[model samples]
Target: MFQELKPIQVETLLETNKNETPINYYQCDSYVLRRDTTNSCYAIYVVKALIEILYQLRNVLFHGELVPNKGAQNVYKEAYLILKMILDKIR
Candidate 1:
């Protein structure tokens, strides 16, 4: 459940793209993900969130919604770092 996640984890999930310029999908719908504790691990929840964010980014890029820029790069970097954290926890 989300309650089991560390404060920083929840905070990161909630606020990672709050300042992304040109706006990414995550900034509008961070609450779209839910705590599906009945059938998944905490890592899966995080991974699912990551996937959702990435999918949104992919859609934006694929559709030419926003020109790639430094802010977009930062979003990618943040994703990679979050992914690394999840991998570290699982390993």
Candidate 2:
């Protein structure tokens, strides 16, 4: 599930350029996850980005912006899987 969501999370991160306004910027007041371009921990960054994506997903749903569609289902599913993965790890 992590592998499946990694690309999507990375793509989201790429699309959200740090120089521009990020999703829920007014509420979060910053990028979901700060990416250190100089850092060598690429895997760590990906994981953090996944978490951030999940956070944004929650905001989208809460704001009633999530359309009931296939794409929305996929995004929600990915976020769910990632959350489950994190929970498993911490336990």
Candidate 3:
């Protein structure tokens, strides 16, 4: 479902995650997420990245590789917001 977000919406999420530090990793440079010359492919790359990260997180949790902690508060909060945004868009 998340993979289906509009290009603009995906860009919005990518920007939010990058600037807001919700993911606790280095900010993803715009070029890394998309071609600098065009906006056509960024959304697809961003959605793919998001899904991959989520899948990695799921695996870590499923395998008990990393225990949940209070520090992940922002992750939960941001995830809900992103999901809500997608739901609202689809509806």
Query: Judged by TM-score, which candidate is best?
Result: 2
Candidates 1 and 3 compared by lDDT, better number: 1
Whole-model lDDT values for every prediction = 0.62, 0.65, 0.56
Q: By descending lDDT, how would the candidates be arranged?
A: 2, 1, 3
Report how far residue 3 has shifted in candidate 2, in Å: 34
Ranking by TM-score: 2, 3, 1
Off by over 4 Å in 1: 1-40, 77-91
Candidate 3's error at 81, in angstroms?
Answer: 3.5
List candidate 3 stretches off by more than 4 Å.
Answer: 1-40, 87-91
Candidate 1 clashes between residue pairs 3 or more apart in a chain or in different chains: none
Deviation in angstroms for 2 in model 2? 34
| lDDT of each residue in 1-91, candidate 3, tens digit only | 6667655542333333333323322345543232323335455666677667766766776788877787666675676577678679989
TM-score against native, each model? 0.39, 0.51, 0.44
The TM-score obtained by model 3 is 0.44
Question: Where's the lowest-lDDT run of ten residues in candidate 2?
Answer: 19-28
* Model 1, residue 2: C-alpha shift (Å): 25
> Which pairs clash in the backbone of model 2?
none
Clashes of each: 0, 0, 0
lDDT of 2 by residue, 1-91 (tens): 8886676632343324444432321113443544445534345666776688889889999899877798888978888987998999999
> 49 in model 2: Cα distance from truth in Å?
0.9
